[model samples]
Target: MPAKSEAQQMAAGAALAAKRGEKKVSELEGASKQMYESMDEKELEKMASTSQKDKPTHNRKS
Candidate 1:
């Protein structure tokens, strides 16, 4: 049996990474589409805030 060439191994690894990245992008797109379709402006705006921002004013300092 022959060993695999370096170029072949690199190509295979790159192809696998590309496939995984594409899957992640597709999932995010689906989520964004669902959110846009289902959420009202107020709800979406509320969701945009960080937890820190949601705390009372006195709880945070500059």
Candidate 2:
């Protein structure tokens, strides 16, 4: 929807990646690392998916 929300979604995805061992917590920075450490796999997945569903749409003004 909004830029802020999109960034949050990206952070959640990064958290999920860390959980899956695709990335390290140390590799992530700032809020992303904090979010990853604060959430479990299920929670991260849920948040990521929810954000994906809320992605902004580009509608042409025809």
Candidate 2: segments with Cα more than 4 A from true spot: 1-4, 51-62
Model 1 error, position 39 (Å): 0.4
Tens-place lDDT per residue, model 1, 8-43, is 223333333334453242333343445445555444
Instruction: For candidate 1, give the lDDT.
Output: 0.37
Residue 10 of model 1, lDDT score: 31
Worst 10 residues of 2 by lDDT: 52-61
10 residues in a row with least lDDT, candidate 1? 1-10
What RMSD does model 2 have? 6.7
TM-score of 1: 0.35
| lDDT (Cα atoms) of all candidates against the true structure | 0.37, 0.72
Which candidate should be chosen as best, given lDDT against the real structure? 2
Q: Give the per-residue lDDT digits (tens) of candidate 2, residues 1-62.
A: 22236667778789889989999778999767987878888888876766446554422345
